[model samples]
Target: MDVVALIGRILFVVLFLGSGFAHLTQTEAMSGYAASKGVPAAKLATQITGVMMIIGAVMILLGVWSDLGALLLVVFLIPTAVLMHAFWKETDAQAKQMEMIQFQKDLALGGAALLLFALYAKLGDDLGLTITGPLFK
Candidate 1:
């Protein structure tokens, strides 16, 4: 069960870890896309959020302060979905469909992060293989 939990955690954070690395390494290209989407200080925002995603992924993967890591993901996902995947603003049918898909994916991930946050906050002691446990309690 502990091993399973560890594997689950690893799988859950994989997207974040990879995407976070891209956010840092592909800063210029990512920031340009972000600017096209009207993100202010796009470069800085990309860098900061990259760090957030990487730190959050590491925390969750290591089972240290997993709740805080989840919160970081929530913080990153919500705004990104709203700002970057504004499907309603798209007029092209295919583009709108793609953006909507991205929006939904982001929301789904955000919801999962929220559940993780709650799990650690309410049941940290019961969780298997944790290091420092939830930072909240």
Candidate 2:
């Protein structure tokens, strides 16, 4: 494996894992905020997102079918932006502002997931494998 690709995978691991930890650590806040966003079954959505983040993080870190992880995250984030942060119910100025912020965050996460998908092959090349690790093959 070349040095640069190794670095990229390391970066992927760090980024995903950190975000995952953030999700796992902030469930109550997340759930409350999601409730404000008018999400149905807010608690379940929060829990699901938290778990997905942790799982995605670990998958990226372990190099275990990280492409799939990336894809799944993209799928999750896109609907999240639309459903949880959509402007329909955000009549108040502050709520609208918060919705915009959340939408942007979700969009950014989706973009990051797409980038991971597009770059996974290069990453694998650098890591000397087609998947995250030996068992992932």
Which 10-residue window in model 2 sums to the lowest lDDT? Answer: 128-137
Q: How does candidate 2 fare on TM-score? A: 0.68
Clashes in model 2: which pairs?
Answer: 63-132
Q: List where candidate 1 sits over 4 angstroms from the true fold.
A: none
Q: Rate the local accuracy (lDDT) of all candidates.
A: 0.93, 0.70
Model 1 weakest lDDT span, ten residues long: 124-133
lDDT of 2: 0.70
lDDT by residue for model 1 (1-137), tens: 77887898899999999999999999999999999999999999999999999999999899899999999999999999999999999999999999999999999999999998998888885676889779986
* Per-residue C-alpha lDDT of model 2 across residues 1-137, encoded as one tens digit per residue: 54565466567556556655666677778788888867888878877876786676666655677776777678778988898888667789997998899899889978987887666644544553335433222
Error of 1 at 128 (Å): 1.7
Best by lDDT: 1
Error of 2 at 121 (Å): 6.1
TM-score of every candidate: 0.97, 0.68
